[model samples]
Target chain A: MMLKYPNGKPYKPKNQTPEQVGTGKVKDFSFGNRGKTLEEEINETNEYYLSRQIAIVHKKPVPIQIVKVEYPKRSAAVIREAYFRTPSTTDYNGVWNGYYIDFEAKETESKTSFPLKNVHEHQITHMKNVVDQQGIAFTIVRFSKLDRYFFLPFSVLYESWCHMKKGGRKSIPLETFESKSYEIIPGYNPRIDYISIIKKFICNKEC
Target chain B: MMLKYPNGKPYKPKNQTPEQVGTGKVKDFSFGNRGKTLEEEINETNEYYLSRQIAIVHKKPVPIQIVKVEYPKRSAAVIREAYFRTPSTTDYNGVWNGYYIDFEAKETESKTSFPLKNVHEHQITHMKNVVDQQGIAFTIVRFSKLDRYFFLPFSVLYESWCHMKKGGRKSIPLETFESKSYEIIPGYNPRIDYISIIKKFICNKEC
Candidate 1:
């Protein structure tokens, strides 16, 4: 029952209950004290969009390459040996209103700025590729401490990440993000109504 | 070093070669084979499609929930513990020519029939959901031993599966598949060349 990474490092479960483990200083700024994680909220919103036939977006399942499986008599097959595979892209992707939508959802505790290290190189490259294909690529950044959310476009993120890499600031300032990114207010019905912003910013003009 | 399924079954790797797997005896009538596995061919085809700007498709990474990690001296992070997560849908999905395409790549060896078990219930449900939203959904079944391929629509597969579950034939006979499915001729460039058939069968009238 011991889950270890390929290098024998222990894996951390991100889905632990807030009560089971302290919130660890990350202040969630998004609406009420509802303990739902960002991913759970987005998943709920995706379900809402799907039910309405408004879009067909889904969170890509966590990727695990199964190396071994045991089929016991009259029971579900059990995986015995598995290794973690490095994913090449961000989590969520699908089509909406004839536009290919790709995004990564991230939560942060810092109230003043979002750290550049939170965005990986592979993700940036993925966003670039999607944008090159004329697809709408963005990231849903939730400042947990500030309870604020923003949809940052790929171009702006790429520029900021690149700048940070070359001796620039380690984090993107809140003022810059506020000015450049589309603010997404969280709600009960659809936790992250990002597509509406997409319709306003990317779809109406392009498609 | 032990992987256990959620149901407490020990994982074991199937010892059979790729040729020995699946229901290949049915017939050589599935798609995706140029002397390589479907995953490799799909990767190549995705690259080709990306280069040509014809589509934006990708294979979702295998989902692994990491439990423990060891950052050995910062150079490498060795995953010491991880568990495989059950994927809720098919492996590959994306958009092509404004149509949302979703499919699962499967290889079988039986020369007479394809077993109903290879396709999972959740995958069927996902495909149905996609079809309900007017998306193009199908499975790319490969008879690797015979080096033949076929594209079976979700509707046909669903009906056959339902029948199989209700005390009908346990496997889909080759004759039924051949008569209803579109044969995809494998090639060097695209490997599957499925879009051509899609154009012929699914999009020609619209155009």
Candidate 2:
């Protein structure tokens, strides 16, 4: 229910941002991502990255096990019956400037803290696998009430997720997020400039 | 219409092997893969690789756009209406041994050659992007009638794809497959070990 779209297709809000917001933008999250969810915004950012030949990130298509389909006269095949299969990895992953970039995007309405339940066991395990292979892995968290987004690194997430599994706090405090993660500056074309943070991460690691 | 699975969900057969076939083992194209299509074998090989902590390759879930979904109480979400969408990238991709592995899996019944129409234009373009990013990319071409399979590198595929646009032959002949590609030695456990060919490819590139 979280990522659901009323039009049955979640897509970029064409011509809404630059024209509506005008040279600048709204002061809060409501005006920041008008008429779209955080996922849609990040997808747009990825598309922007793709068009400029900067990065090759993509949200993996939703997993479905098709039971029946009907083909009608040289047209697209219509799926009759299918069931959603649990996805194994994070929603976004791709090759970026010789490094493997992987991450899950999630948004919460809570103003104080982000719950650990926002992530899943399999996803955390997948992130661990990516980290072990020396690939960059992380999460993009959006706090809607606060109008803020953070590029939470996998190392920080794994520590919290691991702590939760061991009967610790059920949520990562907002203060922790503000201090720990890199702030993702929202912009016009690439709504969430998470890769900019990645460049810095790569830079510090190299140094 | 492409990638359709018979029996609704196409999967590997359970426990039929060389022993089941008379004369020690069935020879030629007939026994190259038993009870499963070439795609399934590669998936198994990927599973083997993942299980051994060697790689993390996966067949991207088939692209489906959900139009309607019903949530029955206490059970998995059932999708009532959906349609297939054209995939932009190849079917398979993952990080393997610190390299991004991406490719399409296609099978042809023709014994002489593989047709170019089996691959879409966007897929070829996607392969070019991956190639440009210094990632390992290729196609797993299966000759079903002859029970033969080959690893066709992206360079060869791109060159042929380019030639086709210039009014050249629309298919790659069997002779070209014999010389330009790596013949996969089909095995029992992993079924088709394409990773072995990838190892050689890596060695040659580094050397």
Q: Which parts of model 1 are misplaced by more than 4 Å?
A: A1-36, A48-54, A64-83, A159-172, A202-207, B1-36, B47-54, B65-83, B159-179
The stretch of ten residues in a row with the least summed lDDT in candidate 2 chain B is B18-27
Q: Interface root-mean-square deviation for each candidate? A: 6.3, 8.0
Residue A24 of model 2, lDDT score: 23
TM of each candidate vs. truth: 0.73, 0.84
lDDT of candidate 2 over A79-181, digit per residue (tens): 7766665678888888877777889998888999999888889899888888887778999999988888999999999899889889999999999898887
List residue ranges in candidate 2 displaced over 4 A: A1-32, A73-75, B1-33
What's the lDDT for candidate 2? 0.77
lDDT of 2 by residue, B127-206 (tens): 88887777788999999888888999999888888999999999999898898888887888777788889999888778
What is the TM-score of chain A, computed separately for every candidate?
A: 0.83, 0.84
TM-score of 1: 0.73
